[model samples]
Target: MSFGAQVLGTLGGIVVATLGGTLVYGAIRLTVGLRLDQEDEYNGADLSIHKISATPERESLG
Candidate 1:
């Protein structure tokens, strides 16, 4: 393909990806949820959700 065609194709692909991501994120946000609360976030997912740290030796980041 020509250079112009390649460029257009790349741009089109990027637009499609962006739109798809936005839609998926919007749906998820409307549904259950996307993120954790302040305390859970500070504790991290491994501890907050699983009740155990992935790295036992090192403490939580916060």
Candidate 2:
């Protein structure tokens, strides 16, 4: 309840969250992967992942 206690709690929370996020991200990167290939990036996520265009009519106009 005191100011010192509140500050300490906030710092502890930040440290815990940062470490937890780093571990989870590292695990995913080592396993299923985290980044897309160049073709996936250029074609876009909507087409690569979902196998469909997000806006086919509008895209054709350009």
- The CA lDDT of each predicted structure is 0.91, 0.94
Q: Model 2: per-residue lDDT, tens digit, 14-47? A: 9999999999999999998997899999999999
* Candidate 1 clashing pairs, residues 3+ apart or interchain: none
Clashing residue pair totals per candidate (backbone < 3 A): 0, 0
> TM-score for model 1?
0.68
Model 2, runs deviating above 4 Å: none
The Cα error of candidate 2 at residue 22, in Å, is 0.4
TM-score of each: 0.68, 0.83
Q: Which is the leading candidate under lDDT?
A: 2
Task: Tell me, by TM-score, which candidate is best.
Answer: 2
